[model samples]
Target: MRLTRPFRRLGPAERRIWDAYPTGAWVDLRTGDKDTDDPVNGPAWGPDRTVRAEVIAALLLGAREPEPGRTAGLRLAGARVTGELNLSDAVLTGKLHLLNCHLSEVVSLTDATTSGVRFRGCEMERIRAARCTVNGLLELDGSTVRNGVRLDNAHVTGQFRLSRARLHAPGERFRASESWLEDARRPFTAAEMKERGLGQDQWAVWAGGLTVDGGAFLRDLRVTGGLRLIGAKFHGGIYLQRSVITATGSHAVQADFMEAGAVEFSAGFTAKGTIRMRSARVNGVLSFSEATLEAPGRTLHLSHAQVEELIWLPTSVKGGVNLGYSRIGVLFDGPASYPDEVRLNGLTYEALRGRWTVAERLSWVCRDSDGYRPQPYEQLAAWFRRIGHEPDARRVLLAKQRRRRGTLRPTGRFWGRLLDLVVGYGYRPWLAGLWVVVLLAAGTAVFAAVPPAQIDPDEVRSFQPFVYTLDLLVPVSVFEQRGAWEPVDWTQWLAWTLVASGWILATALIAGAARVLRPSAGS
Candidate 1:
């Protein structure tokens, strides 16, 4: 049960708002320059511009009921609100707009249900609206909150706008009573603090599990601490264009497991710490075009997420980016936009939307800092093959083999190098045929110049040097002249070389043919 407020006890500003509430009129209490007289810390305003928070709360809660058949609302501009506006668990049918007002204490709207709520250009310490429900737009556009805004588990039926808002979060402090040292019977050190999860609670927007029916417009917003949206759901997408977020934790924008239609972190967006979106799903495009991310370690973490289209054209990145295990429908990227270190293991995409050459695209695959990963190469090759660029697909597969060769032992590497020189790991099968022709011609020329003595002088027909040479070079004796002929001196050594070369060439040809026949054999 709440206390009633009589009209007789209302101050000049409160009485004016009470009378105008029945008509839903705009009560502008601004006198001169509002900037010169900052309502948060300036000299006390006269009665005309000062309203007690209790009177406004009473009107909003129906303790001081308006006339029947009239739509009652509270709309004030440039007023100084004294005391805390505690509207916890209240149901308000009217729309509330407090434009350019200065709220002195914490505005607690915990578990309240309202038609709409707008605090545009208002200055407040903080807002505690945990579990609140808004039917229409819940906007804090252009407002400055010194502490932060907490809307954890809240639901909004309409758009949630916070464009151009400034949020300076109150950083985490040491709670000595809850220290792990007392529990563990040890001294508290930095290592202990890290192991025990003793850290600061500096979050600009703690909206975990928040559900928005419409879009979340956070464009041009500035946050001094982390923006956490863990498990939040946005139907109409999230726009973070031109926003600046800086924080001291592991992630500046921690949005793990969140789901949205689309997410635009583009158009001059800057984050001073990691922007982690682990396991998040977006049904539409997730863009980072022309954005900047600067962190000490991993800059953009998109592991295990699923997105329709991923537009990755960041202006700059100070740290690494991880896209491991993510599935994308289409990926649009630029050659020079990638960071020095990247993680692309288990990443899959249906189509690559770019005009870059195969070499440039392969460079993107080479940026993986965790040595060689075969999946990225295979995925690139598959995409190229789908688009009828068969040669480019072979090039990607050839590079994959070359990268894999680096990790082999000396004996394996020797065999790999021989295969590469002879057949290009079967990606260039024509090289093997060309080598066979060259070696055949060289062998033909060597034996034709110096004739070999006949091993069985009286047994066979005349010694044909070309047929004898062919028999020496072929792994199987198809010509039947090698047994009848014998070579001496340097020609004898050449005959032995031809036999060994024949076996190597035959083995290489068979291996190359097998690989070409089944392209996914070794892969």
Candidate 2:
């Protein structure tokens, strides 16, 4: 076994780790909580449980030669590692397993390739592994990272896990005095931790362009800053069940342009800032069920994405949710799940699953922030038509015309209202028939009371009041009474009024019927 330094210069704890390096045995130096434990109290650790990072790195990088068939690796626990573990650009064949250790400086694995790495229950300042590759699993479950973890453009052949982890943003400083660091009787309180810089609007996990062959499990993860995975590709899906991300004035989780399988952001998930997933592609379901999103600006922006199915039933949303220009195979949502403002323009869904009435669903479309958009109405109407609800589909189209009327000029609006009152924008054809019947009755009564003198007294046809009224009202057919009899004074005026009303009714009826009969004209 090779050594970076002579064995005579090694410390007691370092010598113990070196002796166990060849056999891959664990060098458990943990005694109690005060020995070398805790992330924030690393500065107060004694020399008994301390391990130099260079010594450990050298050993992992072929400093020690194992037996012919024995696997050699570093299995450390409960140690305070001083100095930086810079393994950048190195190809390591051995595995690294650290448990409950506290490393004071940043661990640089930039551009390095490793077999496997596990940091279970460990605490580190940061991990800078940009563009690195991992052949096996990279697990960090139950660990704490004070600054951040940057795995940008990295590729992992196995699973990348961070379940039950706590991560803070970069540039966070420990502001406690040296006297308090050594003489403090207990851990800092929550308020004191805030003063020590717990929250910052930086990237806690910037894994943009990362490609993971297996799943990225982030369940129960707690992050104090943004968790960005923009343009990442995950073949086995990304799970975030019960995760909580708090980053005010910035995006809490930004997975824009990400391609994944069954991304689950459900089950008690909470985020303080926006969760943007613009232009993403998901092979399976993307859910946010039982999640809580609160942001001053847009809470969710899922525009231009394509997903197989979507389950969006968040518990509460403080800011607006935008799903504009997206396409989904199936959608599951509810009225109570929607916020006051939403953007559904150009969003297309094949099937809808909910126990909501047509009115409630229409209300959902009306909540779009862009006022009245015809596409949303058309989309909803098409869904209704697909479900065999022809009347409900017409109702949606009618509402669309009513909303569009408000955007027109005064004369156009007047004409629109006339169409609405007469035919309900072609959706209610019976309204025109009802008006025709009512006007015909009134015209008959008026002509019966005030009969006019006959124009031709020698004509054989009789002056029938009801027949004359019918002749005046009907534009298509003419009765003989209209040619034989003439109306003067009040009767003449009533006849002229009936003829005008008849023309208007016939025109309206033709227009409404054509619109209803032809699907393209109705749309």
Candidate 3:
């Protein structure tokens, strides 16, 4: 509400106003009038009084302590401050609205506590608000900050609106270089530099480590350079609904270990670099529904995060979505292409959004290249069971069994592949029936071609080749046909093969039935 000591008797700030446009008049905060005389805005054609930055700040801080609704805060519009505007460590009880003001130097609100601050339609060089606390909304709507905007360690009680705000922080763009291992080559992956914490924060708009109690509304934000929000935490939902961040380096939105309720990177979010949200925890839905990411590999990495609600990643993803060891409630949907490379090693999603076949779901689960990871499969099966999709759950278990078999030793692999090839790990019961029919037909042909000596001559009235073949296949019962014939020479081999086929078919049918009825043990 009041300027403490040094800022109390602040000198007058200076600015020269031009007479070209309607807003081109020198506005003096001291006399509270527009002056058209001191001359420094332009050349001889300029007619404007010069104003100091401190003069503006001192006048805005008020001659006395600001009252509630009377003169609580500063509301200065279209006033150009020629020097650096320093409001650091100041306390303001009311909102500060600086509209359409142009400052030549950076504005420092470091460690300042204010109710709210709106720099709507203003253009400043830069902003340094480290450790500043805003009780209400901080609106940077339609403003242009040429240099970096640092809000590190700041806390906002209400929403932080950066909609239509143009923040410029030059990032290191990729250049065509010959060296592969050198630092001046292509983009350095965020994985390589995240440990050192040099990711996109050096020369960009860094709000890293800030905590917003309310939601962050950042729609249509165009950061020309890199934007880093590493370690930022939001208590309520954060909506970056439509923002285009084009960082040159590997890490564009370096929001590692962030904690938020619900986050929406939906609608028209195009990022050129990697949007790393690794080790972050989301309490609600983390939606990247309509984003266009140009990730080369694991660019959309959200590894080790715990998402309590749904996570939707539809539309465009040009790289891998690494969700290794993350716990998610439900996966609403995801990208189609490169699904096999999606890092879902230890993902735990309860239920999916859409109704997908068991095969489709298993196919996605099998995308991990580590052969057979039991936890993912078990998690999926448990989720399916919880949702009353028992049959699909069995299919998932069967898929896991087959995959596990594939990863086993030589003998186990052989049997696993054989079972998979024959009956889809005992999930497709009809395949076993088809194999039975095939073996029956094959046996019938061989038996009718080469007739054997009749072991039971009186049973000739029921000597049907097809019936005899089927009777040999069903191990549970027998007909008066197996002992009726004895094959000779090459036909003996055919009979033995038919017997083996019958055993395989019967075993497959029983195994399939058991698998369908029983729940998967591992998960």
Candidate 4:
């Protein structure tokens, strides 16, 4: 009978020799037994020769050891491997690397690590580890470290430093959520220090949930994406001086529900994003001296929060510092008000314009306070005397005197009645003069209307024409009524003449007194 192709190709002994070792190793079984088992313990191969997948798997999985004193370079990419593979204390001088190695099946590198396991310039598609651990410093400094650098629910019992590392993928995320960086207590010496960019061109360190209880040091780091510190707690001061944050999210450095001792951003810190301190309680001062915020849409919103101490903005703040509805314990008085809250000494309206409202408000308050001062009344009286507004000034003085004497009552009704009489008669001096003139004219007319006694008229009827006219003007019945002729009872005429003279004198006195006492225009 003719054998089948695969069965006839390999005999029974050859099949038994092939089944002796693991499935992905490449070695000749007929060469030697010791050589077949230790096939990777050999010299290096050139770049043209293909490295068998079985040998590469055995070497990486620690099932076979590479030869000493000879440097070997192997690239196991796109190879399907199963079960746990450990590559601890392996020395590959010329780049022992893995690219798109499908290890979706069960794979563990627990306590199996390398010195410079550089995935520096390659892309790690997806790596899922259950409880895998690394025991050395894994340096991926200048690499496109991508896609969930997550060691979720795992333990890293060594120093894990990824300084100056970049995240390439769009939503590149990292979460060492519950794990701790234990060896972070060791101080970073000068040689171990990482250089910082002066915000020229660099990406920020993006880590989803980073917890360093032993105090992580990120002195002058830069970030191009959002840093979410959601439900994180730190016991150290987060020094972010001279750091540039260009996060696209709401908050550049969000510590939503965090408890920190102190957060200091002293020297030349800048944020091109909104720093939200919503529902966060800071025990100390949130000082931002010499710091600049250049947010595009809405610059630096600190709306609803409670600051226990002071929120200082002392340095040159470029954008609008909005403390619109925030509550401050003590706001220091601005430069204008030095001593008293009421008095604004040396206040100038021209100096303060469009800068601060406090200056203008204080100036207005000072002017109002000085306007009601009692000294203005005296000063106005003196000014009126100097500037020829004396009449108005005297009126003001009289009004002020009346206002001052408003509470005092008059001593007697006699004085009150005298004042009323004086005021009523004082303004009418011409009326008194006219009354005297009328009384004199009436007396003269009455004397001419009545004639002298008739017996005297017959005895001295001398014809002086002026005297005869005077006699004719007088009436004949005047002497008969009086029973006398020579004097004709001149007492009644003398009494009328005396009353008119007295009234004329009184009118002259009244007019003189009114002219002297009245307020002059230049008073």
Candidate 5:
């Protein structure tokens, strides 16, 4: 095929080629337009108004190459353009890309792909597409999107790389609910790559360092292999509710520094593979309420990360959500914020059956000015009761009371003295009584041995037996007649009898008292 005239526009010859070839075989030509000036415009310019609509349509239907340097816009809807659609540097102000380009084989856009199909550096006001499919990789590194990029249900068989791309407006939503990426390869090598789990020949999403100013949402994306977002920053919240990632691959999502209002990984979804979020900071709550992580050694390492709100792992979840050293602020209240403030009610550790330690260094930065307020003792006691640790809780309460007593009114000097006495000489009372009894008995015995001072022998002899008897019978008479009656002779028997009787009575009284007061072994 040769061009008769200077190929300034698409003609009937090119139109026939487009109509003859399959949709996948239509190769897009580079039009050498800078995308920096206007983000949405494609590189190529279509034919003029003089060309018939039917002819222009035919030219773009499935043609390998459009007329070189055309000045008209191309509209190919459902053309089933096959093979590699090389729109490397084409400029199209209108919607240059269509819904779906039917591909019997693979496709390639070494560095760029767009709804308006721009190449190099071109600017377009708007780019819109509902559903598209590329059999091969879609590479658009260093590209810029202006208003909005919409790719709702696009299917790409190979790896998707949009690293270092800037989205001024809200970026496209890759809601590839039913799309699949089969037999894909990693865009970046293993060493330079910060992400993992790229299958040997499986689909992958590589968007490392891609910045979205107005935020991006991946609502229900189902990636067959790994989805890498190493160092990607999202300004708005990212929701991954009810999404499933299979076990054949390693990582399901690898987004670090994922700062936003909130990030959810709930709704009973299972990640048989690992989910790595090392050093990822979540400004708001990071919820994994009922999600299950099936991988045994898989970890969600957020060490040294800061969370303004809670990092909730409610008791309903099955797998352990390790928050080893991460600092989390207030916890969740309900489905939203409850208690008019962030509470720790929804925060749980049901899955943490084994041993774990909370980081001592990092303190939670609470939003309330009063600072990190720990739960009240009563609340903790109730919680312990519910968990069957009430005794422990009661012990803590008693310990607190003792501490208060020690602090408020300490013991005085008098108490100190009493304590000393009790510890030292308290047992002396019983010993002192025993010694007194022994001394009394010894004095009695000594008196009994010494015969009463012998009354004068002459006086005794003078006293007649009758007089002596009368005197003894009446003690008053003996005192009165001390001069008249002769002094009775001091008899050893009488003295001994009196001393022994007196000692016996005193000993009996002492023994009775001792028996009554002293503690017995059996008692």
Candidate 6:
């Protein structure tokens, strides 16, 4: 298409606008026949037909000249605007709406100030709204931004809706992919997302550090590149329901240190990269009930995060989820079928929401199978005891002990196993007493056949076996039967063996008694 210089001929409306705003260069964009030189051949040309960068900027700011000024407002539809929409550092009070319009270059509002500005169903080269302040909403819904939307530090006073918007343009930060959402009508709560998960082949958007004063709705969005919202904050709830994002290289949704009211990735939400929420603070529930997180390492990197409500992940994670050093209200809120997959090291949860019994709960805590992690078990046991779940608490501690035993050397582990059998780790003390009774009966029978006169120098008769056995076995107590009686050569060996048996039985009994004295473990 051939372009002409600033319009040599202007219609009545075009002349009026050019005369009022004489500082801009209006060009014949030649988008349609409406800007023809002859009015009879096509639609009448006017200020609306002008496709100049400065002209659009002045109109958006309600200025008659290229410099910043105020006017009633501007609402242009099906218009063609040329050059970058550079409104940076300019202040506009009225609503500036550009509907179904096409831009020739990037829309740069970097560090610019404005009120309610919207570009519904418009086609722009790109956008640079970084550090801009929108006193009202700055919407771009149903629009196709070719390059990308850079709202890194932009502040929006009202709601920010990027719902169902098409974002393209691979950026230096992340590559771009087509947005293909799986489901769009589901609720933002992520309730029905169990079994069903997210789907995405590529990732696209990278709007990190975005701050929204009002509610933010990213629901039904589909991105092909990384949606890096690291350190982003919203005063209200952030809905990511039915959105699919991929992390070709970077994280799919890296919202680290983000603070929001209710941040959800519930229904039909799928992510390929790490959904990092490190050090994030959510005032309400941060749910991913039916979402699929698929990063190989650190799939859901939520370390040091504080969520006020339960962090749901029933059919949620695909690769693995890391909650290390995180503080959650209810840590595990789903099925305990495969507990070994979730990492809960250094995690502290107030309540556990699993249908499993006390043993099952203990089993879930040790699911990582990453060897003995004393901190995880200790933290879990402490939490269980705090809520008067004494039995559960004891079970957890027992699990910790067992886990620790498994990692010991062969000799140490064997010794531990011996203790487990003898007294059930001090769990059963009666077995020690039963051993004493059996040993006393055997010793009494053996000594009854031998007479004390032949074994001793003094003239003593046959001894009472029961009395003699009692004196020989009771090492700590004095029964005084062996004082005057002595056994001959071979008989003396039997008596000495009995003395050693007495010492062994006494030690076992004391050990069992000590275990019984302490708190009892759950059955």
* C-alpha RMSD values across all candidates: 4.7, 6.2, 6.7, 28.5, 23.6, 9.8
Over 1-523, each residue of candidate 4 has an lDDT whose tens digit, in order, gives 3312223343332233223322332222222344332213222222222223334444444433334544333343322323333342333223244432323222223333333243332223323322333333333333333332433222233333333333322231321212112211233344333221211112233332333332333334445544454434434434555555554333455554544445555466666555655444445555565666654333344434344444344343323333333444333323332212222222111112123342343232333233332222333344445657665445444333333333336753343233223332233344445644555455445545543444455554422222422222233422232233322476355433544455444544454355336554111
lDDT of 1 at 43: 33
Per-prediction TM-score to the true structure, in the order listed? 0.92, 0.90, 0.75, 0.32, 0.38, 0.72
Distance from true position, residue 427, model 1, in Å? 1.1
| Most accurate candidate by TM-score | 1
List residue ranges in candidate 2 displaced over 4 A. Answer: 1-8, 32-40, 171-201, 463-466, 517-523
How many clashes does the backbone of model 4 have? Answer: 5
Residue 35 local lDDT, model 1: 65
Candidate 1 clashes between residue pairs 3 or more apart in a chain or in different chains: 172-201
Give the per-residue lDDT digits (tens) of candidate 6, residues 3-101.
Answer: 232446544433434443433333232345433432222223345554566655655565443434434455655556666778888887656676666
Candidate 2 per-residue lDDT over residues 302-361, each given as its tens digit: 999999999999998888899999999999988898889989999999999978988898
Residue 493 lDDT, candidate 3, scale 0-100: 84
**lDDT on C-alpha atoms for all candidate structures:** 0.84, 0.83, 0.69, 0.37, 0.38, 0.66
lDDT of 1 by residue, 324-377 (tens): 999999999888777889899999999988679888888888888879888999
Model 3: worst 10 consecutive residues (lDDT sum): 15-24
Candidate 6 global CA lDDT score: 0.66
lDDT per residue, candidate 5, 251-326, as tens digits? 5566665555566776654454456666677766677666655433333444445666653443232222344445
Clashing pairs in 4: 24-54, 25-54, 204-223, 450-475, 451-475
Give the better candidate number (4 or 6) by lDDT: 6
Sequence-dependent TM-score of model 2: 0.90
Please identify model 4 stretches exceeding 4 Å from their true place: 1-210, 249-251, 303-523
TM-score of 1: 0.92
Q: What is the model-wide C-alpha lDDT for candidate 5?
A: 0.38
